[model samples]
Target: MSTPYAPPAGYGDISFVELVPLALRFLGLGLKLVFLALSYPFSSTKFSLKRVLWRQFVRAICPPSSIRQLQFVCPATGVLYQKYMRSLPNKPPVISENIGDGISLHWMGPKTNKKVMYYLHGGGFVLPAVDGHFYMLDWWRNEAKKRHGIDFSIAVLEYSTYLIDCTSSCQLSKARMIGLINFAPWPTQLVQVAAGLAHLLKEGYDPANITVVGDSVGGHEVIFLLAHLIHGHPAADVLNLEKPLAGAAALSPWLCFGTETTSWKQHGHSDVMPLGALNKWSGWFIKSRTRTDDSYYFEPALAPAEWWGGLEKVAKNVLMAGGASEGMFDDIVTTEKAMEKGAGKQVKLEIFGQEGANHNEALVEFACGDAPGSTNYRMLEWLKEVYA
Candidate 1:
């Protein structure tokens, strides 16, 4: 059994070295502001208060700073933990010990419950899971309990969150300082995901009662996993007969690889993720693998219409939600079309486009206050549809 978690000696503060990039970022933003002001007189573009201010804010502060590129130091850092725990003590989750499949699964509701919603978090397969994700899951668990007498068990098959949320502080700080750097190769992680689910099935949990949710690259993982299950991978056979899942959802799922969709730049203005970074990350992940640039797992857009249809047998209902202003919006919109075409009407589907919202906008607790509803609101409706 794993030991209980311990807190860090102090707040996870950034060193002066880390702040050097902040200074550089400010200078860069200042120059951009000067340029925006100077260019406003001659430019033909009409500016709104929100757009102009946001454009400036993003230009100045949202790029990949030294923090991201340099500090692949450890996936084990709990830098975001203390703040999250303080903010949401009422929604604490049960972090499982090494479940033997080498995957860290965190459960957010009734410890003995069988109704499981397996969640995979997004961060371009590189960054950490933020606190908004946990809060949203907790809210869903509470709502599910209230509406139906069911205890929703959220099995977070995630990495970064488990690093902080599950481990001891001595491990967190030392892991950061050790500066070890390595990422699990492509299909290896996917295979482990299949194995993780198999473990649950092995434990006698019903696959028919399991639902799935994910965002961004995690959403990509969802699609890949479904495709594998629908095709009857031996791992999925643990549940028998390849029966469809109860339901599934993906938020602003990153589906395209190799080429940027027109929407990436079209909607990049309000998004924090830059096209170059997206390209670099995706490209970097696939470089050492055997998969081609157009492999279905890596690039679903190029796959046949039937590939998505396969998911109908994989998930009975699939909900996809994204910010209209997100760089991946068009791609997700296209994915919905492909799924509908391929699934051949067996699956119920919902597509939500949050107007003026940016990428992965639905997962965060903050909604930018510009849209009518939230990702969580739609998620609740979808959760009820599946569980009820």
Candidate 2:
């Protein structure tokens, strides 16, 4: 197996070196806000005034080039963990552990819980988990126990972010060396995810009791993991299962990496994340791979329906949710249908889309301090049924 990418110590901490870029990013955001205020009324997209402004802000902050340049400003997993701990109503015991290869597993509830939700967060694979993700996970755990009497622990996988573009190994100028560094990419994350599942199994948690939950790129990771389980990654360690996982919830999963799609043309302005940014992020992810035909691993939307065969061997219950306004809405719908078709009618799979909502709406609402929305309610009901 290849060595995992271990981030430099204090990589998350902001330094004087990052100040200039950070300041410039915020300044650009301020200017973008001014433009939004001036153009909201006359915007081409018929979204609400608030949504139009949000789309602009998301576009400004999420440009792959900008994120790669000012990556330190995005808080790391450790910082997110601390913030999540503080937000909890009842303090649980310290439950974080390093699970080899720079990956860490953080538990929101006690490990003694019988059921587990293994969570992978999404920030286009370049960003780290945020305060909102933790809030949403905590809410799920709390609500599950309160409403359905299901006591499940959440194991948040603190995987490495794809920060650098170090596909080239040749000697480079000092400028190029400083600007481009590959922290973790494609197969590295797949291996890390396999390690996480291996850890859970080693700790005596049955595969049938664990549900894999992911959002955005994190949701993409769930799909990647499922595909890996079926077809296996050449670089990643083998992850064998005695039984199917309890369930998997992929919300607003980035299924397709390309920018050309009907939804992209229609919801280009309605969604928060721009397709241009997604394309750039996807480039950073797959640049290091040697093979040319590995697109199936990164862009599952391109895979044939037959490629999803045997998905039932990975997870018993699958929930695929996306926002109707999201650019990848069609891809999500198509992928779900393909999964059902490939896995046959016997497979338990479902798809959800909410009108007027944009990618990962449930987590975004939790981040904004609102109660769980309709999608969250639906997911909660799904969980109750899965655990029952």
Question: What TM-score would every model get versus the actual structure?
Answer: 0.74, 0.86
lDDT for model 2 comes to 0.75
Superposition TM-score, candidate 1 onto the true structure: 0.74
lDDT tens digits, residues 1-388, model 1?
Answer: 3323332232234578766777677787778777777777687654443345445653454345422333332233233333454466574543543454334555565546778888877766555555656666666778767875556787766442111111232232332322111224455456656766776677677777888788888788777777777664432333342567898888888888644667675766447566656655565565534345437766665567777756666788988899888888887878788888888778887789877777776664331223324776788778888887
Per-residue CA lDDT of model 2 for 1-388, tens digit only, reads 1123244465545566656766777798888878878887787875555555555666776773444454565666655676668656676565667776556777788888889989988877667777888878877878888999998888888874344434454122211212112235456677788788889999899899999989998888898889998998887878889999999989999888765788878886656676677766677666644456567777778788899899989889899998887888888888888889999976799998887788788887776565567888888998997887
What local distance difference test score does each model get? 0.62, 0.75
- For model 1, the run of ten residues with the poorest summed lDDT: 160-169
Which pairs of residues collide in model 2?
Answer: none
Give the CA lDDT, 0 to 100, for residue 162 in model 2: 41
Best by TM-score: 2
